[model samples]
Target: MTRKPALAVVGATGAVGAVMLQILSQHADVWGDIRLVASRRSAGRKLAVRGEETEVVALSEDALTGVDVALFLVPDEVSARWAPIAAAKGAVVVDNSAAFRMDPEVPLVVPEVNPHAVRVRPRGIVASPHCTTLAMLPAVGALHAEFGLRELVVSSYQAVSGAGRDAVALLRAQLSVVAGTELGAGPGDVRRAVGDDLGPFAAPLALNVVPWSGTLEEGGWSSEELGLRAETRKILGLPGLRVAATFVRVPVITTHSLAVHARFENEVTVERAHEILATSPGVVLYDDPEAGDFPTPADVVGTDPTWVGRVRRAPDDECALDLFVCGDNLRKGAALNSAQIAEAVALEIGPGAGDRRGLGSGQGPGSA
Candidate 1:
C-alpha cells in the first residue's frame, strides 16, 4: 500500500506490446519498476520506457518474480502458456489475448463498462475481450445501460494492422502494385502482381475486402464472427442475447469500425441515444452527416476513446437504433484495456495486491 508496485509487460516486442508501452507512458505513473519482457529472441533487446532504455527479458519463472501485475500482450497460444506462469510467480495477470476470454473464472473486463469485475480474479487473472468485441463496448455499452439491449446485428470493418506487423507491410506493397488497375481486379491480384505475402489473412487485402477474419466454425460463421457474438454476450451480461456479426477485413492500417443495429427492450430515439452517448465516458459523439462530420479509422486512429456517429432510429423497428463506432484496434482494443484493468487492480488491492491470497508475495498461480 505504501509503494508503487512492480509491473512486467510480457510480449514486449510484438505489435500490442509496443502500444502497451506507449500507453503506460501516457497514463499517470501507476507502476513501481517497469520491466520489458518477451520471447528468447527478443530478450536482451532494449526498449525505452519513461526515457530509460529497459532491457527485454525472456519469459520464464525467474523473469516474473515479485511482479505485482503482469500485463500480457502476446498471442493466444503464448498467453495460454505464459500467463499462468506469470500469475504463479505472484503477479496478477491481465491478459490481452483470446486464450482466456471465455474462461469461467477469468473476468473479461472493459473498465468503462464493468470495472468491479476486475476485483474478483478467481484465477488471479483478468481477460481482455477480442479487439472487435472491445471496439464497440463504450458506445454500445452506454446505450445498453440506458435502453436495455436485447438484440444486435453488427458488421465490422477491421484494419490489417490487427493481423500483425507483417500484414501491414504486405498491404502497403500490394497497394503500390494495384494503384490504378481496378485495384485488386480479381483474385490472386496481390499474389500475381505483388509477391505471395498476404500474411495470415484468408484473401488478398490490397483494395479488396475479405469477408472472413477468423477460421470457419459451426453454422458456417467464421470464428471471428462467433467471437464477436460470444464476447458481446459475456461482456454485456446478456447470455441469451440475440447477436450476430459479420467481420470483414479492410485495407486500413489501424482502427476498426463497426456498423451496429441494436434493438432494445424499451423504446429509443436517435436524439435520446445521442444525449446519453455525448455525456458518457470514453465515447466521442461525432454524428452530423449533413456536414459530413462522421468518424472513420482516419479520424480515430491512435486515439483511446470510442468515436461514435450516425445515430438514427431504424425505419421499421421502433425499438431499434443504428450507429457507427470506431476505435483504435491496438489501443483500447488490446493494450489500453489491459492497462486500465491493471490500474483497477492496483487501486483495489493496493500495492500489497493479492498477497493475502498468495499472489502478492510471489507465490505460484494457486489452483490456476
Candidate 2:
C-alpha cells in the first residue's frame, strides 16, 4: 500500500491558492491528507476539494505539525513570517512569492530548467520563479542548453490576475462600464462606474495599460520587472546573465505573454531553435505564421504549458533569436510550479519518506 504525503497550503483562500487546490485535486494520486491554511480572517471559510468542502485553518505554528510539504501562496510579508516556522516544524516549504526568489541559498526553481538545484537547498525553502520568468524558462533553458544564453530582452503583457483577485474584479467591473459606454450610456453611467476604484492598480485598468507593477525599486524598474530579471538569472544558474525586463499590466484576466529577444554565445538558426523548443519539456511550439499561428494570452489562459510561437532570427544574427511566449500566470507561473517542486521533492526524498533533513524532503526553514 502506498502512503500519501500530508500537505499544507498556505494562503489557501487566495487566487493562486485556490488554483493550487485544483491542481492538487487533479493529481490526487501524488498527494493525500491536504490541509488548507489561510490567515485569521480567512480561517473557517470552506473551500471545495474534489467535490468535498474543506475548512480553511489559520496559519499558525500548530498548523505545520506533521505535514510533509507546505506550499505557500501568500503575500511576501506572510511568507516571510511563517515560511521559516513551517520549515522548522518539519514541513518542506515550496514558496510562490518574491520573498525568497533571489536569495542565494534558496533554490529558485523551474522544474524543467533546474531540477538539479533541488538537491542544494541549504535553506529549507524552494521558491517558484516569478510568473514572467516561469513562463519564459522552458523555452529559454532549451535555447541556453543548445546555444548558450548570453543576454535577454523581455517585455511582458501581464494579466490582471497577476496583480491579485481584486485586480480581476476591477477589470471585470471596468469592462462592464466600457460595454455600457459603447452602448451609448450617459455620463452618470460612465463616471460613476462600478470599477472606478482601482484598489489593486495605480490607475484605471479598464481600457488602459499600466506600466507599473508592484512598487518602483532602484533604477526605475518596478518590482515585477526586477523579479523577472533576478529570478531568470537565478533559475538559469547564470548569476552574471544580462537581462532586462519591462512588465506592463494588461486588461486580460489570466495568462501573461512575453516578447523576448535573446543573444546566444554560439550561432543559432530559427529552425534549430524551433527544433529545440519542440522537444523541450513544458513548452509547446506553436510557430505557424502561415496559419497565423502564434501564442496569445487568450489561448494560454487555463493551460499548463508555456505556448511558444513567432520564432525568428534577428536581422543582425549576432547569434540572437526572437520569440513570443504565453502561459497561464496562475498555473505554471505560480501554483503548478510550486506543486511541481513539491512533487520533485517528494520523488527525491523517496515515496512515503517524511524526513525533513534532506534537500528533497521539502522541509527547511527560510534561508533568506
Candidate 3:
C-alpha cells in the first residue's frame, strides 16, 4: 500500500496556525499522523484537527521526526532559524514568513498563479507571499495572462489581524473608546482618545487609517509596500514589472483589501476582464455596483477565494484597468497558501515515496 505523507504544522497555536488546523480538516485527506508543533510555552495544549485532538509538542529537532512536509506559520526570525533545519531533516518546508520569499533559491509561490515554481525549491523550502500580495494576485495574474501586464499601481487597505492579535485587540479597544462619538471629526480627538497603545501601528486605528503598515525602507517605502512589489514580480515571473504600492492599516478585523491600477500591454475592456476573472481558479468576480454589489473586506472576511469587484477599464487609458480585491489574510493570504504548497509538494513526491519519506532522502523538489 502507498503510504500517505506525515505532516507537521509548526506554530500550531498561532492565529494563522489555528486557521491552518481548520484548513487541514476541510482539505482532502492526504496526510498521515499529523503532528502539531509550537513554542515551549504553547506545548502540551490540545488542538483539534482531522476530527481528533492532538497535543502540541514543543518545536525541536525531535518534533520533526519522520515528517514528510512541514508547514511553518511562525514569525520571520523563527522561520529563518528553523525552516532550513526542518528541510535538512527531510521535510519540505512551506514557510509563511518573510524569511524566504525573496531567497533566490526558494520558490515564492501562489498555487493559482505559479504552481510550477514549487518544484524548483533548491533550498527544500517553499515561500508564501505576503498576505497583502496574496489578497489580489489571483485576479491580477488572470488579467496579466490575457492582456500582458505592464505596470501596477496598488494601495492596500490591510486588516489588523495581519499584524497579529495585539493589533486586533488595539483596534477593538479603540473602537470601544471612540464609538458613537465625534472623535474623528476633530483633529487629535481620536488620537488622544486612543492614547499611546498603537500596538504595531504607527497611528491610531480606531476611526482613522494609518498610511503605513511595515518597517520603513529606503526611498520612504514601507516593508509591506516593497514586499507587494517584489513578491508580485517573483510569483508572476515578471522581474522588471513596474509596481508602485502604498500599504495602509485599517480598522478591520480579518481581510486585506487592495485597490489596483493595472496597466497592460494590450487593450483591455471590462467585459473581457469580467469573463476572465469569473472563470479564474481561486478567484471570484463580484462586480456589480448598481445592485450594491462589490467586494468589501466585511463581506470577504471568512471567504477562501479572492473576491474581485469594482473592476473597470481606466477612463483615460485603454491599456489599464482598475480593480478592488479582497481576501481573508489568515486564509489564502497565509495558511491556505502554505497548505496548498505543501499539497503540491506531496503530489510531486507522489504516493510511492517508500522509506525515503518525502524530500528528506536527498531527493527534494529542487532536484526534479
Q: Each candidate's lDDT (Cα)?
A: 0.86, 0.83, 0.90
Q: Superposing every Cα of model 3 onto the true structure, what RMSD results?
A: 1.6
- In order, what is each prediction's RMSD in angstroms? 2.4, 3.6, 1.6
lDDT string, candidate 2, 146-179, tens digits? 9999999999888989878887887887787777
| lDDT measured at residue 317 in model 3 versus the true structure, 0 to 100 | 99
Per-model tally of clashing residue pairs: 2, 3, 1
Clashing pairs in 2: 92-362, 92-363, 124-364
Segments in model 2 whose C-alpha atoms lie over 4 Å from true places:
180-196, 354-368
By lDDT, rank the candidates, best first.
3, 1, 2
Worst 10 residues of 1 by lDDT: 359-368
Find the 10 residues in a row with the least total lDDT in model 3.
358-367
Better of 2 and 3 by lDDT: 3
Instruction: Write the number of the candidate with greater TM-score, choosing between 1 and 2.
Output: 1
77-107: candidate 3 lDDT, tens digit per residue = 9999999988887788999999999999999
Output the better candidate (1/3) by lDDT.
Answer: 3
The residue ranges of model 3 lying beyond 4 angstroms of the native Cα positions read: 358-368
